[model samples]
Target: LFGKKYIVGGNFEYETELGNIKDGKVLKLQGLSQKHRIETTKMENMLSYNIFASLNLTEDFSLLGSYTSTKSKEYDSDSLTIGGKYKFNSVGDVVNTYFDNLSGNKNDRWRGTVNILLEAEDDSDRTYFDMDGNPYPGDYAASTLYVPKLTMSLNDLKSKWSYYFEGYYKDNEMFQGLKTNEAEQHATRVHLEARWNDTFSRGRYGINIAYRNETSEKPQNYGKKGFREVKRGVHQIRLTPNFIYNLGNGFALNGSFTNIYEYNYIGDKEGQGDFIMENQGGIDYSGLMPRAFMRLNLFREDTWHDHNNATERKRLTQIRPTFRYFFGNGAYTQLEARFPIYNGGYSNETRTQIIKSENYETRYGIKYIQPLAPGLTGTIGVTLLTIKAKNKATG
Candidate 1:
């Protein structure tokens, strides 16, 4: 890292020409990647980073090729990328981009090097579990990782895709990827995501799809028998399509639809793989101004699960409202509230659903924010009221 501000990178290239062809060349290849982080203000309270592959040529210029990943804690973003980059004056400005990008998509073009990366590093992490109200102490974290990220931008049509796979067959789960034929002894996790965005002059809209996979297999040499593929390989997929549009004066419309699918494997092949399907939707409205703004959102979700191959159904609805007003000297007061209008989780499951429930909870809170020092902001929040109400019926 270059002084905690910018990430440094280098490339090596060798180019040659073909003999008996007109305007044609055959070039051999190598590989390079870049990761950088830009420091933001304390008020932002975000962790932002970017990673991308390199396609270098000539003295100090190259067009961007493929594979880019960017993440931020605040704001729903798909991906931020550019056409090409040029380096002339300084080294820290390697990924520096000009505002006048060749691509017509002119939404979030950054000046100077703005990129990042996140690497999960650990010796070994463990977790504790409970079964039948009895504390069971045997859980493991993912120790190996192989992530391949990809992003593409053509004018206003953009996409970000990534895959994080933990381990393969016969490799050690507690170490890096190497050619081996041994028993892997620990549990693992997988994460994959794909998102697309279309940002124009008025507002932005996008669709996000994510997937998660996990395994809970036992150790290679544990329990009454040896390790097997008994309780392992579970999957979950979430698809969300969202939009926010401007309404000219002081109001905007926003909403999202979330669809989910799940699968799992248990004991031989007797257990089901596709066990659950969920659908959720939320609508939001915002009243905006220069110094103050407020937002209100309503949501509804319908989901189900499985146990012993007997499926059940569930449904819920929620409402959330928030308001914030800014003071003269960067001080602000905000209020937020959330309550469930309806919640039902039981509808004929003999294995796991013993009681049908509805009406879960209600919450409300308020907070004040003030600037304390150069790099600090003070916040005081209080939960004014909360109501927990549940109605149960016969199973």
Candidate 2:
């Protein structure tokens, strides 16, 4: 992007990774497991910077901003994003706002991840491989994040239906002291959309919805409230439908469907327990040339997990199909397929004890492009795969 009237830009980056390790003496293949220490060493360094700005502030208002910085020796971060926009001339409208701030230095010991809520334990699924047993490498904390957003849209409407809305907020924190392993979280989000069209005819349709909510608290014994504050909540909902069609010599078709629902409340205000459900669909096709394409997909998922006091149920199914072709000098061809199924247990099992698994896969590929000499080009490819499975156990 370039400037025109107060539009600036900047970018800089540096990266490095070097490795050296030798003292080897480990090898014992066959069914795995038999290594007596193979050493490794890696050192990484990174630096980054970015800057941006835009303004035209009067003619219906506008301003945009950006700043980003990153440094790593294991993490250091910075970010700032700003946005604003407003315009309305009768029925045509637009509104937008955004804010962001992020800061970091994270690495809290005992196998990191902010100390995993001080090595969480509520009824043991066991984890905590060392500290008193020796190898406990972690500790470097200080983190922060905040985000805000809002959006509204309905532009140049001459009516065929149009609408959009959005809202968002997020906050996260970690400091590793204030009671012990301090952590915090909060989230909120919402989105909506609607559409219908034939602007010039090719068809279009759309509907979208989204919602999210989250709350978390830590410190319930990391120092006895020094920051392991166990409190959790999460909720999510989503629905989507989209379509597009244009079937004329250049062909085109598109489709989308999605449904997702989730709910979880643990400890701190428990009720409504656990839940999850998901569904997905996809379809796509494009003319036979100029780089052909095809796609099909379906997915389903269900969960009802709730620990120790038992409640378990899980189901998953997935299917995917893909095809691609292109040839002119840059030859290409591809085919792909996948299927998956798994059904789970508990919910007072039955249905033959409810546990099943199935899987199948296929893949194909071909590529060839050779015209070496004058602008040179060369490529070669080969790929093939096949897989099948049923009821688990495989070798």
Candidate 3:
């Protein structure tokens, strides 16, 4: 970020991990009961840091802030975040709070954020194959954990279409960081979008839709004493749609779809629900192959689940291909599933099992995207986090 009034950004990360592991030949005081295999050599390390800032003095007011920290052996954390954009409403602290200008455009309409967290714990990182649980591994007792989070954003930008609404909350969240279920969350989201691009003989298209809802708690943090981490209770819903098109001389077309639903409860056990669907379709090309481009995709997924009266189903399909080329500073490279391994060609890789988030089975792959300076770059991994939260909640 450069600066209009003010802007700042920062990041630092360090990580290391080394191979070979499989040690489970137990039977003593330093371990529990494993009864088998062994092979070793492992190493790990991690470190993280981040910093952020933003501010705009007039035209209704704006401000933001951030801080983050992490160390690992599972985790050790710290976080702090602040938010702003104001016209009316008053608050204390942060320099006595002042943001006069009462709506002269309210920075295009509201934005807010708040986050706080602190975590620390170490119980020798147990897990050596149960057997009377904690048969060994340090001594322990509860210690440290405090979490808080909130986010709110609402917007509607002039013409050409747009929509936004967002809300989220947390107080004891740790799902996806799962160290034995942990939860407490609330979420609300809405998005809408529209576009009619230009420049290829003046033709292109766009569409977007989104919805989300959530609530939760189960085995959530702050649970201990014989792992007394609560027991299920949740409700969730999600819906998404996306699209793109540019039938111009260079050709393009795209699609997307998703659905999710869930309900879970537990008392004496037995109560669950789930249904999910994932879809995709794509086509792209760059006539004449100069900077080169070609993309093709087709993917599908299905799922269903219900508790002890049982019902479960799962399905999947796939085919994704890409061959990209570009160079001259903003480097680029791509080749995926370009087949051939032990002779035969053609592949989309599949190992049959699916819960999704990919794990190449025979899916050939190659990637190279360089330009690591001048705004720095070198990254890949796209679209997820609920479809980028509807592309940043309608921009």
User: Which has the greatest TM-score?
Assistant: 1
TM-score of each: 0.50, 0.23, 0.23
Q: What is the C-alpha lDDT of each candidate?
A: 0.49, 0.51, 0.48
lDDT for position 154 in model 3? 32
Model 1: worst 10 consecutive residues (lDDT sum) = 35-44
**Deviation in Å, model 3, residue 27 alpha carbon:** 64
- Put down candidate 3 lDDT per residue, 1-395, tens digits, no spaces: 33558777777766655332223333232233544333122224667777887677654466777777767665455666666655422222222333434433224332222322222222223233234442233222222233333333333333434444444444433333433433333222232323222224433344444444444333322223333334444455655656667778887887777777766654333367777878877888889677988888777676666555455455556677788888867888877652212212111213432222322223566768777877556655321111100111112
In terms of lDDT, the poorest run of 10 residues in model 3 is 384-393
Clashing residue pairs in candidate 3 (N, C-alpha, C atoms within 3 angstroms): 182-220, 183-220, 219-229
Candidate 3 segments exceeding 4 Å error: 1-99, 102-106, 109-153, 156-234, 237-247, 259-261, 266-270, 278-301, 309-311, 314-395
Minimum summed lDDT over a 10-residue window in model 2 is located at: 112-121
Candidate 2's residue-wise lDDT over 18-121, tens digit each?
32323222444334465334322212456777787767566565677777776654445677767766655543122221211123322121110000001110
